[model samples]
Target: MNNENSKLTISRIIQAPRSTVWKAWSEKEHFEKWWIPEPITCKVVKMDMTPGGGFETLMSENGEEFQPHVEGCFLEIVPLERIVFTTVLTEGWKPNDPWLSMTAIITMEDASSGTKYTAEALHKNPEDSNKHLEMGFEEGWGTTIDQLEKLIMKLA
Candidate 1:
């Protein structure tokens, strides 16, 4: 479900087990592999899966020179079920003005087909939501999810 007021959402039924999908997300090494749209690369700088813990990554096109991607903190973590993170704060609950501010909620659940993965990006206002949509949120997020499923399939 998506909210036109200030949220954009996407969900998919990943044809893999929840544990495996969670492993791909919880492990930084595995996370770095599919966190971004490929051809471009992602480098996981830090991922501490706890309340007030940091989650940061750098991205690059050439694989050498990297640029800042996401520098944020995890607001909540429910083991393999859900994770809430916000870009408005850094690790340890420190305030930071990000280029774009958003809090993301990611949920994974068991499904008959596989794992039901949902991602919701919550913005402070519709203007920000529009900005993200204009920036190709659907395609970008969808691609990464596809990459994730592909990575899991490959590794399996």
Candidate 2:
């Protein structure tokens, strides 16, 4: 159930229960523990997990902070199953460019004694998708998922 041309999608099978993985994503405290890699701390500036709510995260590594990534309103949220939110990077959700917004859909499914996590990012055009790929998205996202797996396993 994936299309290569339908934006960007990353899938992983995490060895954890659905509830635990869902909590790791929905809870801000649990989210910070695995959202970034080692030596880099991730903090949620603001997270309101609901439709029309904005979520912001700040990534700091070696005491140096990179520009925070902000996602604007959630278009859809299905508890323990899926989250569809719009990605808009701006201070306090205000779009400076007014032309950069992507729809990100994260889905969770029950697998064989584990959970399937799928992150699908729908960009406005092919250029945006190419940009994400050029940004070492595979390695970056793989590391994030690896971090998540380690954290969730500790909980289990």
**Best model number under lDDT:** 1
Say what the RMSD of model 1 is: 1.9
Model 2 local distance difference test score = 0.78
TM-score, cand. 2 vs. native: 0.85
- Give lDDT per model, in order: 0.94, 0.78
What pairs collide in candidate 2?
Answer: none
Give the poorly placed runs of model 1, Cα more than 4 Å off: 1-4
Q: Give the least accurate 10-residue stretch of model 1, judged by summed lDDT.
A: 1-10
Candidate 2 lDDT at 23 equals 89
Clashes of 2: 0
Expressed as tens digits, the lDDT of each residue in 93-118 for candidate 2 is: 45534344577899999999699999
lDDT of 1: 0.94
Candidate 1, 73-137: lDDT as tens digits = 99999888998999999999999899999999999999999999999999989999999999999
Give the clash count for each candidate.
0, 0
Best TM-score among the predictions, by candidate number: 1
